[model samples]
Target: MRSTPRKLSLTGLVALTATSALLLTACTDASQSGTDGSTASTDGESSAAPSFDPSTIEVDEAAAALLPEDIASAGVLTVGSNTEYAPAEFIGEDGQTPVGFDIDTIKAVGATLGLEVEIQSADFPAIIPALGTKYDAGISSFTITEERMQEANMISFLNAGSAYAVASGNPDDIDPESLCGVTVAVQTGTIQDEDIAVQSEECEAAGEEAVDILQYESQADATTNLVGGKAQVMYADSPVIGYAVEQTGGQIEQLGDVFDAAPQGIVVAKDATDLAAAIQAALQTLMDDGTLVEVLDGWGSGDAALETAEINPSVG
Candidate 1:
């Protein structure tokens, strides 16, 4: 497969030019949430939207006590995430506070543990590697995979899978499985990115034209290219594709059911076993208290809710 780089990753691009080119990428997140493009109210009307009011949640004694000694004393859970992933984690309308189902859920978890949640944004791929050093945990819609579980403990929190999308009516008739010569767009360092790269190699070995795989820094840029006719198909986490289709006002359409459905987890450093247990307990408390349901539903991602927050659930 031919790899294409976005302006943000190309050093030759002028800084000013790269800034404008990466606007959509820097502002949006890739996690799929089936939002209807109306997260904010237009007129003066009430909506059962998500509210991350820390004051609303009270601390659970048992959960709090479960926290590691250092974390319990510090009173904070430093989380690293790619804030540009929408519905899961993203910048709020004011363009300052990070808000989304992921943010709210983590805050709720912290509240249960009597800790303050501090979210720090970084590149999605970087977040995983920086755990333990720069972040105590990561909750950026990370799919629990064997490769990832090798580096950190994955505590299952939500369910998600890959989804394919195409222009309305599938103008180019792109097939998810048979994209031998198709120009496909995907975000960098995601499972879909690696998946397509492998598929491209398979196609070439079969005497078919290699797939033209375009990699962008963020899902927003990938979706933009799809809608602007720069690519024939786009693949991302299922909820992400749904949200993109919704935001596009029917310009894009999801191709099929979410496949390879697996648990998306909160990543904890390998050495932070105590902290991981504390987080699992806190998540269970939130799940039982209906906070998890509310946050997911409010963000149009209720379908991805987990029945229980398991530790290292089977990836295959």
Candidate 2:
């Protein structure tokens, strides 16, 4: 019989709930003035939108000014991440040092800007809300989304999507549809969580029992569960699943194609536009110099899908 994965303890649930509340507090002020001179509320807000003069807005200057003297003077960029997401970010073979594609890319970007990079581990979903006054930026394979844009500024650097990792031999053929009535493991409070929720809805619509979506605190835990047969499949980023398959000596296989394409970005405080621009410019330079591709290559991650251009605005 397969060993069952452990459920989150009541204390853990309470802690997560409290952290989510803090994150919500951090995003409460995401409203911005619309170009039509009206106020636009984001997420679930009912307030009127604010208006802005697009003609008078100097994009370059605005982005540049967002990186104020204080941040530059600090000389160190404090980053928050749950580095358990492999290929993107993870502990090295030594098991103590943080290492991965995300770390390398962010380090290169920091070097270009003459700043020191420091990474702090935090709950994946709580990283953004923990940004204010504590961290300078966040680099945990964060996806750029309009909902997130309302609460924080995201400077996209990589094209990413969700995929599955399963035990070899492909016994279950775990596609999204196959996931119905099965136990699927995912990191809690991430885009993966949102994706699984959508899949669950689909299962319900098809008259099948919705999969039991098991939530792990980190990718490492989720992958462990997959190998232990506690879960039918592990859902995670495509690049991450690729790395895991390679590292496991074919013990695992990445199944199916990409399901959701969510561009990855660096997260800065909602009000930190200058810092966002500086990071964006640095990323652009990395792409031009071929450094970005080299970093991804080092981690055995796919490089052809990288997007060199800045896809979103510095501030929402």
- What are the lDDT figures for the candidates, one per model? 0.69, 0.60
For candidate 1, what is the lDDT?
0.69
Q: Rate residue 90 of model 2 by lDDT.
A: 57
Query: What is residue 108's positional error in candidate 1, in angstroms?
Result: 1.2
Off by over 4 Å in 1: 1-50
**Pairs with backbone N, CA or C atoms under 3 Å apart (clashes), candidate 1:** 28-84, 29-84, 29-85, 29-86, 30-85, 32-239, 32-240, 33-239
**Positional deviation of 191 in candidate 1, in angstroms?**
0.4
Measured by lDDT, the strongest candidate is 1
Candidate RMSDs in order = 7.1, 16.1
Q: In candidate 2, what residue range of length 10 has the lowest lDDT sum?
A: 5-14
Q: Give the alpha carbon lDDT tens digit for every residue of 1-316 in model 1.
A: 0011110100000001112243343333222211221221213221222565766888888878878898889988899977655556666544456776778889888988899889997788777779889999988878777777788887877877777888889988787769899999887877788888899999999999999998876665677677667788887777777666655556678876677777787889988888889899988888888888877777677767787998888856
TM-score, predicted candidate 1 vs. hidden true structure: 0.84
